[model samples]
Target: MTQMTRSAVGGRLSDDKRKAIALQALARTESIRVLAERNGVSGPTVKMKTCMSRG
Candidate 1:
């Protein structure tokens, strides 16, 4: 993955946050849509994060 600059707009989530959210999804704590909405990202983004966390 390419590194994003500090000045970049609409910043991406940190790896830690992404991992936490992925874990939550795996644990069934909440719906993926809810997690994505609460995190200000799209559902697909959350889904992708979860997929990445798997491997």
Candidate 2:
């Protein structure tokens, strides 16, 4: 698998912050792709964040 650069990893946001943002975005957006694009992150990353937050 390809590795993400630090910036591409959304390092500016802490895990807690990322989860909060992901949750809010997931609630408001129809597509994870669009939310990830808007937040400068990968869709799988956002999906993982949501899953992590839940579990």
Candidate 3:
């Protein structure tokens, strides 16, 4: 599998923050675009977090 590198955004999201984002993403409770925008992360980053949660 390919390594997943984080984006060079303003700063890194804390572990708790990442978990929170991943939870909401995996739960399918909100739109990915909205979540990414609100969290200041790229859409792909959100998807990557959810994918990482799989393992």
Candidate 4:
């Protein structure tokens, strides 16, 4: 799992925020790297979130 941080994007996101991000990942409007960076998380983290949401 990616370490949660408090830099630009801040610490761990709320469940709602995570769900929203997962939805964004599913939308595929942006690359995983771009979405992760924009959200201050790792690409794999976003991927994992997306996968878990599907699960």
lDDT, candidates in the order shown: 0.69, 0.69, 0.78, 0.79
RMSD of 3: 6.0
lDDT of 4 by residue, 26-52 (tens): 999999888888888777778888999
**lDDT over C-alpha atoms for residue 22 of model 2:** 69
lDDT of 3 by residue, 1-55 (tens): 1123325551478888888889999998899988887787877888888999989
TM-score of each: 0.73, 0.64, 0.79, 0.78
Ranking by TM-score: 3, 4, 1, 2
Span of 10 residues, lowest total lDDT, candidate 4? 1-10
Which ten contiguous residues of candidate 2 have the minimum total lDDT?
A: 1-10
State how far residue 11 of model 4 sits from its true place (Å). 6.4
> Where does candidate 4 stray beyond 4 Å?
1-11
Model 1 TM-score is: 0.73
Question: In candidate 2, what are the lDDT values of residues 1-55, reduced to their tens digit?
Answer: 1227524567677777797766866586568777776677777777877777677
lDDT for model 1 comes to 0.69
> Quick one: best TM-score, which candidate?
3
